[model samples]
Each structure stands twice: as C-alpha cells, then as structure tokens.
Target: MVVVGGGQAGLAAGYHLRRQGLDFAVLDADPAPGGSWQHMWDSLHLFSPPEHSSLPGRLMPVQPGETYPDAGHVVDYLSDYEKRYDLPVQHGTRVDAVRRDGDSLVVEADTGTWRARAVISATGRWSRPFLPAVPGRSVFTGRQLHTVNYRCPADFADQRVIVVGGGNSGAQIAADLALDGNVDVTWVTQRPPRFLADDIDGRALFDVANARRRALEDGRSDTGGVASLGDIVAVPPVRAARDAGLLYAKPMFARLTADGVRWVDGSQSGADAVIWCTGFRPALAHLVPLNLRGPRGHIPTDGTRALSEPRLHLLGYGDWTGPASATLIGVGRPARDAAREIAQLR
Candidate 1:
C-alpha cells in the first residue's frame, strides 16, 4: 500500500499501518519530513493541548508549562515521530496520479512509480486555500493576500487592513494586528462569531464531535449536545483582544470596490489591504485518475474508504473523509480504520 502525504494525517495512517505490520510506504512531496505544517504562519498554534493533538501510538511532547504547541513545535514533533517509528517515508516524492492497472494501482510520482494493491490519499486541505469570488476583487488597488501567504501582522504596520472570515485564523490575526495597534484592522464575518469560553476549548469540542460521530455511526439517537466545533476557542491572545475591545467583527460587505468594500446598506470602508482567512478546499488532484471525487472536490467515503473506489481511500481531507478527520487529534481514528482495512486485504 501507499500513502500520499506526510503530515499529521499521513503520519497517523503510517502509524496504524506499521502497527498492522503492513508493507507500505508514505510518499511526501515535501523536501523535509514536516508537510504543510512547515509552511504555516510562524505564530500559528494548536487550539488543543499536546495530549489532544498527537498522532496515534505517541503523544506530542509538550514543552514545560506550555499549553499549546506552535507551528514550529508541531514540525519538530512530526520530524521526531517519523524517526521514532522508523516509518518508510520517501521524502521529496510528489505523486502525480493514481491510476488503476490490472488488480493493483499505479502511483505515478515525480521520483518513480509504485504499483500497490491499494492507495490512501491524505493530501489534506492546506495546500489549496479557498478564495471567494467577490465583485471588483481583481480591481482593488490594495494588496490582497490569503491566509496561506500571511506570515505576521508586523508586515502591515500602520495600514488599514480588512481581516475576513470568522474562524480562528481571522480572530488570531486580528488579535495580533490589534495587540500593539500596529495596524488599523477591521474584522469581517458572514455571521455572528460564537466564541467558546476558555474553560470549554477545542479539546472539549473535539471530544464532543467524536462522541457524536460514534453515536450516529452506531445508529443511536444521541447528539452529544454539540452540533459543531467550528467556532473560535478563546485562546489567550484572542481573549485579550476581546477584553481590549479590538475583537469587533462586522457582517461581510456586499462587494469589493476599487479602493475598499461596500456594504449592502450603502456603507463603505476604505482599506489598504485585505487578508482572506476563508479556509480551504481539499487538495485531491492526484486522485483524478480514480474518478472518485464528488462535489467540493471530496471523495465520498464509507469511513475512510472511498465509496466509489474501494481500493482508493482518502484520509484527513475533512469530515467528508472521516468525522473531524481534518484536525491533528481527530485524524488518528480514521487513519487507523483505513490502515486496518487495507492490512486485512494483504
């Protein structure tokens, strides 16, 4: 078997495959062990603790007195994890396509080809950031950047900036920008933001989401009192921003203008730049040869195994691949299941 991706999701799948003693290799396109995580903004940190954000078979080692691991910390952990497990990871190998060849599948990559009995595509979503099509977006005179390219708030000092999206990225970036009044920042959200209190953070929400998923899977009529964990968790920076009255979020404007954005009520705000944190779509172009993708570029799956192509499973894209499977903590379950099923065939 072959796993395409070396990030948390792929590592989780590798962990499970190793436990099953399956002959498999994880092919990562990255030059180093850390996948997309190495490319995230420097200040990004996990909302959950190290204990809740670990891959299967190992706990992410936490620094003394640290609650959350930053992006660099995670990269180090993943690097150490690959070494610790002795996982067969072929670095710098970019998979171009996965096509059917007789009873086996052919994994065509930049390095070489591998004919495997099954394939698991865990390319993840970070590589494909989603940017909404807004009118006059192209005509805006100001600089525009997606969250994928945003590094730090220090770059936009004294500039009028519009931070778009209601997720943690927007909130965190807004907080960073507002911390020292470095930038004049305006936050925009499609709806009112629901901030989870500090006491009830992402760890609790992850637990609830998993429990809810299990209940539904078992055909039990239990909701577990949580519909979604997509809201913002009140991390220290975000909390401070809220306390300082800098976390104000307004509804999204109707359209973009040449110099600014216009609201539905004829209101407009001039801005020097826009930071879009609107999230991402799954990166699954490599699986086009399998013809397993559906709406939203997702491969419909039964758990982690693709419904249309049973031999072609997808991991860590999102809930469509597996319940809460996009998160560092949530991916282990689905990865384990997918590996086990593939092992059974061997």
Candidate 2:
C-alpha cells in the first residue's frame, strides 16, 4: 500500500495504517509530511479546540483553560508527530499519475514508479485555490489576492480595500483591517455563512457532545448559531464581531469594475485591493480514471470507507457524510477505518 500526501488527514491514515502493520509508504509533495497545513494562510488556526485536533493515541499540547490552539501550534505539533511516529514518508514525491494496470495499482511520481495493491489518497480538499470569475478581474489596477495568498495586511495599509466572501476568513480579515486604523475596508459578501460554536470553558466535553447530538438528531442546519453551547471554549468570533460592532452586512456582489466593484444594491466603491475568501476547490487530478467526483468537483465516495476503487482509497479529501469528510477532527475515524479495510485487503 502507498499513501499519498502528508497533511493531517493523510498522516492520520498513515498512523492507523502503521498500527495495522501494513507494508506501506507515505508520499507527499511537500518536503515533509505536513502538507496543506504547512501552506495555510498565517493568521489561521484550527477552529476546533486543541484537544479536538489530536490524532488517535496522541494528545495536542493543552492545559485546562488554556484556550484554543492557533495555527503555529497545530503546524508545530503535526511536524513533531511525524517525527515521533517515524512514518516511512518520502518527501517531495509529487504523485503525477495513479492507475490500475490489470491487478496491480501503479503510481508514477517525480521520484519514480511504485506498484501496490491499494492506494490511500490523503491529499486534502484545499489543494486547488478557488477564485470566482468576477468582471474586471483582469483589469484590476491595484492588486487582487485570495485568502490562500493573503498573509498580512502589510501592503494594503491606508488603501481602499473590498473583501469578498462571508466566511470566517473574510469576516475576520475585514475586521482586522478595519481595526488596523489605516486601511479603509469595505466587505462585500454574497451570503453570510452560518457559524457554529463547538466548545465552552469549565464544562464537560460530553455535555457539549450531547448538545451536538441532539442538534443532529433534531435535524438542525449549519446556518444558525448553535442554540446549545456546552463543550465550546468560546462563542464564535462572528458573534463576537457583532458584539464588538465590527461587521457591516450587505447584499451580494454583482460583479467587478475596472475602478473597483459594484454590489447588488447598485452601490459602487473604489477598491485598491480585492481579497477573495470564497473557499476552496477539491482537485483529484492525479486519480486514475477519475473514479468518482461530485458535480462540484469533489471526490464522491461512500464517506467512511475511503475506497473509491476496490483496493484504491482516497483519504483527507472531502466526500459524502462520513468521519473523513471535512473538519480536522473528522479524519481519524475514517482514516483508521480505511486502514483496517486496507489491511484486510493486504
């Protein structure tokens, strides 16, 4: 077996695969095992709490009442976890193609070719940057950046900036720029995302877990703030932004103009820079025969199984409802389950 890409999801699968005693090697395009986590924007962190970010059998550094861990902590921990596990990982081995040649699965990479009976795809969903096609994008005079490329506001100080998207990134970045006391930030979002709270301090994690279960059992949607807050450490930053008077809600964007942008409300503004926090795209470009992908270009699998092909599985990347679909915490169950499945195959 061969595992591809070494992000959290990939590494989770590798960890379980290790315990399964499978003869497998993990390959990643990055120089190390931490793949996409190593490439995220600097000002980000796991929205989930630190304890939730742990892999199976490993605990992330946390003390009671310490607050949620940030991006640096998550990155540093994943880097260290890879070292302690000593996973047989080949860095800089960008998998170019994966196909089934008769009974054997073939993997072609920058390093060389390898064959296995099964393959685990753990490359993650955010591999491809998604940018919506807005009018005048090509004609923008100042600068345009995706949240994927945005690190800091160093260059946009004192400039008229219009940020697009209503995710946590867009909301928070606009608020940050506004708080910077130099840049004039205008936030234009098509729709505000529904935020959810996952934890609260001084409460039992199980209490919070029960509330979530009730919400799920009651068929609650992701569009509203959770009515029940148990294990969550704090309220969502979006709600906090409202409490702080940092948000200005508006209609969707119609398109962009050479001078700036025009919103659905027939309002026009001069934007020096446009930052798109519009979210990510899942690209399984290297998959053989492109087994199954949904209409939106995500791998459409049966969720937890991870096997898009009989002996071929895809990890990390988002799929239908199962343990391995989206959140960092969602990876372990599916990764380990998939590992067990792959072990049986071997």
Candidate 3:
C-alpha cells in the first residue's frame, strides 16, 4: 500500500498502517518532514491545547510551560513523530498520478512509481487555496493575497486592507492585521461570524463532533448544536481582537474596483490590498484521471473508503471525507478506520 501525503492525516494513517504491520510507504511532496505547518505564518498557533492536538499513538511532547504549541512546534512534533515511529515516509516525492493496473494501483511520481495493492490519498488542501471570483478582480490594481501566502501583518501597515471569509483563518488574519494599529482593516463574510465562547476551545468542539459522529454511527439521532471547525476558537489573538472591538465583520462585497471594493448597497471603499482569508479546495487533481471525483470535485467516500473505487481511500480533505478529518486531533479516527479497512481488504 502507498499513502500519498505526509501531513497530519497522512501521518495518522501511517501510524495505523504501521501498527497493523502493513507493508506501506508514505509519500510526501515536501522536501522536509514538517509538511504544511512549516509554511504557516510565524506566530500561527494551534487553536486547541497540546493535549487535544496530538496525533494517534504518540502524545505531543509539551514545552516547559506551554499549553498551546505554535506552528514551528507542530512541525517539530510531526517530524519527530515520523522519526519515532520509523514510518517509511519518502519526503520530496510528489505523486504525479494514481492509476489502476490490473488488481494493483500504480503510483506515479516525480521520483519514481510504486505499484501498491491499495492507495490512501491523504493529501490535504493546503496546496489548493480557494479565492472567490468577484467582478473586476482582474482590473484590481492592488495586491491580492490568500491566507496561504499571507505571513506577518507588518507588511500591510498603513494600508487599507479587506480580509474576506468567515472561517478561523479569516478571523485570525483579520485580528492579526487589526492589531497593527497602522493598518485599516475590514472583514467580509458571507454570514455573521460565530465565535465559540471563551471557554469552548477546539478540544470541546472536537469532543462534541466526535460524540455526534459516534451517536450517528450507532444509529442514534443527534439533536445537538455541535460546532463546526470553522467556528472561531477564541485564540489569544482573536480574543484580544474581540475585546478591543476589532472583531467586526461585514457582508461580502459585490465586486472589486481598481483601488478597492464596491459593496452590494452601492457603497464603495478604497483599499490598498485584499487579504483573502478564503479557504481551500481539496487538492485532488492528481486523482482526476481515476474519474472518481463527483460534483464540486469531491470524491465521495464511505468512512474514508472511496464509494466508486473501493481500493482507493481519501482522508482529511474535510467533513465530506470525514467529520473534522481536516484537523490534527480529528484525523486519527478516520485514518485508523481507513487503515483497518485496507488491512481487512488485503
């Protein structure tokens, strides 16, 4: 078997597969072991506490006095997790395609090909960021950046910036930019943003979601107002922004102008730049040749196993793939299930 990614989801799957004593290799496109966390902003921290953000089998080693870990810390943890398990992860190997060859799957990559009995595509969406198409986007003269490219807010000082999207990324980036008093920031969301209570962090939300999922799995109806991962986790920066009255979000703009945005109510605002905190689509273009993708290019799965292609499994693309599978803490269950299913099939 071959696992086509080395992110949190891929690593989780690798752990399960290794424990099951399966002959599998994890293929990662990155040059190093840190996966996407290495590319995040300098100060990006996990919304959940360290205890809640750990991968399967191994607890994340805590720092001397820290409860939450930053992106760099996560990178180190993932790197160490791979080394600790001695998981066969081929870093710097970008999978170009996955096609069927008789009963086996042929994994093509820039490095080399691997013919495996089954394949698990755990590649998350970080590589495929999504930006909404507003009118006059092409004519907009100012710089436009997605959350993937955005780093520190220091670069946008004294500039009129609009941060779009209602998810955690949007709120976090908007808050980060607003903290810099020099930058004038406006947030745009399709709907009113919902910030989880100060006490309710990612851990609580993950627990609620897992409970609901288990209830449903056991044929029970869940009548709970469970929170989605997108709900703001009241991280320090976001909480500070809320207290500072900087957590205001407006309806999305109708279109873009040369210098700024044009609102739906015929109102206009001048802006120097637009920081699109918009989310990402699943990076499954490599699987398109298999013709298993459905509408919205999402591969329908039954508990991580592809519906159309049983030999193919997809983990951690988002809720469609599995409940909270996009998250570090939430990915373990589905990955374990996928690995178990693969082992059973073999």
lDDT of 3 by residue, 292-345 (tens): 978887888888899988999999988777888988888998999998999997
Q: Write the per-residue lDDT of candidate 2 for residues 218-322, one digit (tens) a residue.
A: 799532222343212333554455566665656666777887877777888788888887887665788846466556675556544433567767666643434
lDDT for position 24 in model 1 = 90
Q: Which stretches of candidate 1 lie over 4 Å from their true place?
A: 222-230
Note the Cα lDDT for every prediction shown.
0.87, 0.69, 0.89
* Model 2 TM: 0.84
lDDT of 1 by residue, 1-346 (tens): 9999999899999999888888899999998988888988867788888998888888989866678888888899999999999999999999999999989999999999999999989999888899999888998999999998888888898899999999888899888888868799999999998787678776887878878888988899878434454478888889999998989899999999999999989988999999999999888889888887687677778888888878888899877778788888889989989988998886
> Scored by Cα lDDT, where does model 1 land?
0.87
For all predicted structures, in order, the TM-scores are 0.96, 0.84, 0.96
- What residue runs in model 2 are displaced by over 4 Å at the alpha carbon? 63-66, 197-240, 288-291, 304-308, 319-321
Query: How many Å off is the CA of 131 in candidate 2?
Result: 1.2
